[model samples]
Target: MFNKWINEPKYFNKEKETIIIESDAKTDFFVAPASDYLAHNAPIYAFDVQGDFTLECKVRPDFKAYYDAGAMMFYVDEKAWIKFAFESTDIGHPAVVSVVTDGASDDANGEKVDSPSIWMKLSKKDKVIGLYFSHDALEWRMVRLFQFDVKNLDKASVGLEAQSPAGLGCKVAFSDIKYTDKAVEDMRKGI
Candidate 1:
């Protein structure tokens, strides 16, 4: 029921290839390339998930732009989705743990720490979806929780995205992607 929301996939055509989809602009499909040293954009992948599910992926940023973002995306149209990422402007700058929803951006910038690997785990249970993040694949933090009108989540196809507008062609690598109905209760309690 949600497949119509996604457009054809676009690839980077590099050795560590990645795919980009043109989401329906009318539904909230847009990507912000790095505008300056202060901002880098996040890409969204639209889906219609209404039940308990989990999406996890690995991301490696190639450039050092402020707010350089990479994360698993859960898009409701174009204006709505959840992005969990590690962003920083430079090497000396602390990486911020951030999230954007309903066109509003919030971050745990002061809680910055070193994380070589990042995973975003989104779960839908009882009409509410929880957004969580982790480092070292073990400890997870509850970044936020929200509700959406999603119902046919399982039928949705997740997409991979990377945006490094400032570094023009600065690429991010994504791997080990998995979508399942696995229980994330333990992760939630630790948050």
Candidate 2:
């Protein structure tokens, strides 16, 4: 795992390498900072990104409240970021969720998976960003694709994120964390 930035989690065990966060009341990372009500702060365990890179993690989320999720995020700031997660639903089922905030948060919901543990991967090549998820490590599926405006930013932040948008807090275990300085050979292939 890469080193975590100053925005660390609430409770972290260095020996076990476990992270636990107590969600701040009404906290999330969204845009429309001027007038929109969706913006709330969450702990972002960030690491700097370079030219082209790929990062993956296996996350098992304990969904205690609505919208609590384990996420992998790429953030330029509050105004621009990509959050790909498995979010807890009100219907008692979890769904694959991806929210790209480029001024405004475009929250998109993907196919629901039955498993509590999910695998997520994100890659960036120049300005284009790709999001993907997998049931098993062998096969990966695309979640969404978009062009992030920032390019050649030597220190763009990317890392694990946990948020409980509507409730108190949640538990998220992120293991088998993998980070590589090189970009995926082909973004379309999702290698």
Cα lDDT of all candidates, in order? Answer: 0.48, 0.75
Compared with the true structure, the alpha-carbon lDDT of candidate 1 equals 0.48
Score candidate 2 by TM-score against the native: 0.87
- Top of the candidates by TM-score: 2
Q: What is the C-alpha RMSD of each candidate to the true structure, in Å?
A: 6.5, 2.5
Q: lDDT of model 1 at residue 150?
A: 46
Stretches of model 1 off by over 4 angstroms after superposition: 1-50, 89-96, 103-110, 148-158, 165-169
lDDT of 1 by residue, 31-69 (tens): 433331222233444455545677766666554454444
Model 1 residue 3 CA deviation in Å:
8.7
For model 2, state the Cα shift of residue 130 in Å.
0.9
lDDT of 2 by residue, 9-125 (tens): 555443355554444544466564356566647777777877888988787878888888888888776566788888886667898888887778877778888998888889888
Pull out the clashing pairs in model 1. Answer: 27-77, 27-78, 28-78, 28-79, 29-78, 48-153, 49-153
